[model samples]
Structures are given as structure tokens and as C-alpha cells.
Target: MRAVFVRPGGGGVEVRDVDVPEIGEGEILVRMRVCGIDGTDLEKAFGRPITPPMLGHEVAGEVVESKTSEFRPGDRVFVHHHVFCGRCYYCLHGSYTMCPLFLKTTIEPCGLAEYFRVPRTNVERGAVLKLPDNVGWEEAAFIEPSACVLRAINRAGFRPGDSVSIVGVGPTGAIFIRLLKSFGASVVAAADLSSFRLEAARRLGADIVVNPLEADFPEECRGATDGRGVDIGVLATPTVKPLQTVLDTIRKGGVLLIFGAPEKGEKAEIDFSKLFLRETNIVTSYSTSEVETNLMLSLIASGRVSLRDLITHRFRLEEAEEAFQTARDAGRSLKVVVEA
Candidate 1:
């Protein structure tokens, strides 16, 4: 089987002939249909928190073989990227993602391969969900990221009539905008340096789009909320500046959600006096779990969220390099998928 893997020492991904993963008891084998190339994949390729073995996590495919009776050959499914240990302290306390074992495990042989193995833990623990007939492989591949957005929005706790401001109109940011609107937010504003992303955000139902480079973003957000500032501000860019902007745009007693993963060791300064006196809150979200992933799958299947509009490009496994390049230059692209 052919697989795209990260070479050691920050080298680019290389196509290699690797053995197909073997299925264990209660495990399932999926014939890869489509894998979403994320910003994390770019970070991994550059050797940030470098880990060997499989890399791709946002995957969807047909069940080629299975040892469990719950699933069988020809069943379409979406694979959950992370697996949690049920006996861990975090799991016992309902903080499954914080479990040490979940962080230690990786999807064997990665998602960017001709075939990959689904762990017994994921299958038995309800990590994998059957894809609906109306959803195609490309749209189903978005389930992972959509689940992440769902988790972030849930943590932010937006009220039905709350004013919302989102910084960064990338794939994740755009998804956040759509979800926020669906939650009945009264005012939805999105900011990004790229006009392409801002346009994409508009298409995703953002009420207002602001180009941070050409406008006073904080002032614009403030004006949009009638000088009270937005009720909630979501920082969806990996840059530290956006975090500060989120803080500035959020009103007193408002919430700030940091949804983007900044580079390691990144730092930003904030006005402690404002945070203290205003009683503002700051929160960050990481990966998604089985529970949230299942919800996102349902939402996608129901047509409440459109994953089709988010996919702007697709590449084959052999075009992995080109796909990475396109993702790196995200100003012109939204979500890029690599098909098997």
C-alpha cells in the first residue's frame, strides 16, 4: 500500500510503500476514500511536536474488513482521530480528552494511506460513526473539524441574542461563524486579512466581514455592538495579535474563546486591569471527542451545516506536496482534501 509520511528532521512528506495495517479483535479496516489536510499536518511536517507513524486524522472511508459484528464490509464510516482510555482519571471524571493515554496514542499508519486500521478502543467505545447516505466522502471528512468547532462554541456559551465577533476567517473560523449564526446570535462579525477568507465567511453566513489589514477591526466590532463591544469574541487565528484583538473587542463580562493553535512558546500581553475589573473570561479548546463528533455527523447529515462549501480543493495521495503548499498559502483556499 502507498502512504504519505513525514521524513525525520523536518523534511517534507515522502510517498512510500508500506504494509497494510492488520486488524485486531474488535477492530475494523477502512479503505481510504478521502482525508482532510489540516494546518496540524503542516506543523507535523515541519517537525513541530514531531511523531512518527500515521499522520492524517480527519478521515472517512468504506469498511473493507472488520472483526466486529457492529460493522461489516462496505459500510461507510468516519474515523475518530483520538482514542481515550475508559479507566483513566480524566475519563472517570468526564474529561476524556485530558486522559494521558489518549494523548499517547496515534492513528496507526495515519489517514493518508490506501488502507488504515481502526483501533479496537475506537470501535468498541463508539468512536466511529456510520456515514449517512446523503453525505459524500469529502463532506464527511469535515466531521472532525466541525466537532472541534462545536466543542469550542459550546465552551464559549453564546446566548441566543448575543453579539459575536470572530477573528480569522480560515476554515475553522468560517465553520465557527456558521455555527454561531445557527445558535441564534444576533450580530455575527468575522475578521481576516485575506479577502478570500472573508468572502468565504460571508458565504457561510457571516453578517459582517472586516479586513483587519484595511480597517480598524476592534473599532468595527465595537460599533457593530453599539459601543458595548461584542458579547463574545472568538480568536480563530494562530497568531498572538488576534488574541489581543479578541480581548479588546469583548465587552465587560463577555467571554473570549481561543480556538486556534498557536505555535509552541508563543506569548501575548493583555491588560490585567481590564480583565480583573471587567470580569471577562478566557478559554481555549483542543481536540474533539466521540460525543461531539457524533453530534457533528448528525448536523452534517441533517444539512444544518454545509461542509460542501468549505471544500475548495482536492488532491490525490501522490499530490501530497502540492496539497501542503496550497494549504500553506491559505489566503486563496479554504479546506483542501487528499483523496486516496
Candidate 2:
């Protein structure tokens, strides 16, 4: 089997031949069909790499072997990399993503491999979901990410008909637009440094688009919401430099949701006086849990929302380097997928 590995501290990836993962009792082995590349994957590959390099997680595949009765051979499925222990304090408090076990459980050898093993813990915790017959492979690959978006919405306590301003219009940002529109948002305003992404946001149903580099994003967003600023502001990029700008786009007592993951040691400076006086509420959402993933899968299976159009690039497993570069560049591409 072949798997992709990131070169630490260097913006590069290499494909190496490795033994196919072996399944243990109550475990399962899946043959990769398609996997979606994520911004975090690119960040780890290009920027500072974490202890374990990021490869792929938004994945869909065909089951080749199963040791549990919940699934069987020949089932098309989407596997979540992380699953929480429902008995933990975090889980009991509705913060499932913060469960200690969530970070300990993952698919073996990462999701960018030709084959990977699903651990028994994940299997029993409902981390694997069977794909509907009507769902295509590429669309199935969106399950994990769409689940993430849905979780963010839930964590932000997003209300229908609330005005929104998104700070980044990348792939996840586009998902936010689609989901917000479906939930009956009064208006959706998207902002980005890339004109290409702004246009993509427009096509995805953003009522207003602005380039922070070319114009005043806060002013434009405020104007769009009748000079009261937006009800909620979302920071969808990993970089925290634009965080203040996102805060400025929110009205007093509004929520500022951080949806992207920034590297360790990254810090942002803010005026505590204003943050206190304005009563700006800050919230963040990490990875998704089984609860959100199941809902996202059901939404996809029912054809209520379509995510197939977000896929703008596809690369073979051997073309892992090019795929990483394409996503890192963030030009003329929406979502990039690596197919086995």
C-alpha cells in the first residue's frame, strides 16, 4: 500500500510504500476511494508541522473487511477520524469535541493511504457511517467537513434570520454560506483577499462580497446590515491577523466565532476595553463529533443541500505534492480531492 507523509518544517510531501494496515478484533479495514484535502492538512504540510503530520481526514471508501456486525464487507462508508467518549465530562456538558479520548482515537496510518484500519474504539462509538446508495463517492467525501460546519453553527448558537459576515471565503466558508442560506439567514456577506474566492462566494449565494485588501470590510459589512454591523462574524481562516477586523464587523453584544485552527504559539492582540464595553462574545469550534456527523450525513442523503459543486480540483494519489500545493496556493480552486 502507498501513503502520503509530510516533510516536517518543509512544504513538501512524499509518497512511500508501506504495509497495508492490519485490522484487529472488532476492527475494520477500508479501501480508500476518495479523500478531501483540508486547510489544516495544507497548514501542517507547508507551515509548522504538528507532532503527527496531517494527511487526510475527510474521506470516503469501500469496506474490505469487518470484524463487527454494525458494518460488513462491500459497504460504502465515511469514517470519522475522531470519536469522543460519551461518559466524559466534556461529553456530558455538550462539549464532545473536547473529550480527551477524541484526540486519542483516529484511523490508522491516516486517511491518505490506499488502505487504513479503523480501531475498535471508533467502530463501537459510531465513528463509521454507511453511505446511501444515491450518494456519489466525491459527495461522500464531504461528510466530515460538512459535519464540522454544522457543529460550528451549533456552537455559535446561530439563529435563523440573523445577519452574518464571514471573514474568509475558502471551502468551509462556502459551506457556511450554503448552510446559512438554508437556515433562512436574513443576509450573508463574505470577505476574502482573493477575488476568485469572493466570486465563488457570490455564486454560493452571498448577498455581499468584499476584498479586505481592496476596501474597508467593516464599513461594507456594516452598510449591508443597516449600519448596525452584522449579528454574527465568522473567522474562517487559520491566520489570526484579520481577527480584529472580524470583531469590528460585529455589532455590540454580537458573537465572534472562530471556525479555523491556528498554529500553536500564535497570538492576537486586542483592546480589552472595547471588547468589554461592547460585550463581544467569543466562541470557537474544533473538530466534529458523531452527533454532528450523523446530521450532516442525513442532510446529504436527503438531497436537502448539495456540496458536489464545491469540489474544484482532483488529483491522483501519486500526485500528492501537486494537490498540497494547489490547496496551499488557494487560487482558482475550491475543494481539492485526492483519489486512490
Question: Best-fitting candidate, measured by TM-score?
Answer: 2
Q: After superposing candidate 1 on the true structure, give the runs of residues whose Cα lies further than 4 Å from its correct spot.
A: 50-54
- Supply candidate 2's per-residue lDDT for 298: 89
lDDT of model 1, residue 150: 90
For model 1, residues 1-340, the per-residue Cα lDDT tens digits are 9888887666578878999999999999999999997767777776354233456888999999999999999999999868788797899997777888777665668899899988887787787899989989988899999898898887788778999899988778878888888879998989998988988988888877888778877788888888988988998886667777788889999998987777677788888898999999887888888879989998889888777678888899988888877876767998888997
Shift of residue 143 alpha carbon in model 1, Å:
0.7
Backbone clashes in model 1, listed as residue pairs: 54-109, 54-110
Error of 1 at 142 (Å): 1.0
lDDT value for model 1: 0.84
Choose the strongest candidate by lDDT.
Answer: 2
Model 2, 40-81: lDDT tens digits are: 887778776432464899998999999988888999999998
- With a 3 Å backbone cut-off (N, CA, C), the pairs that clash in candidate 2 are none
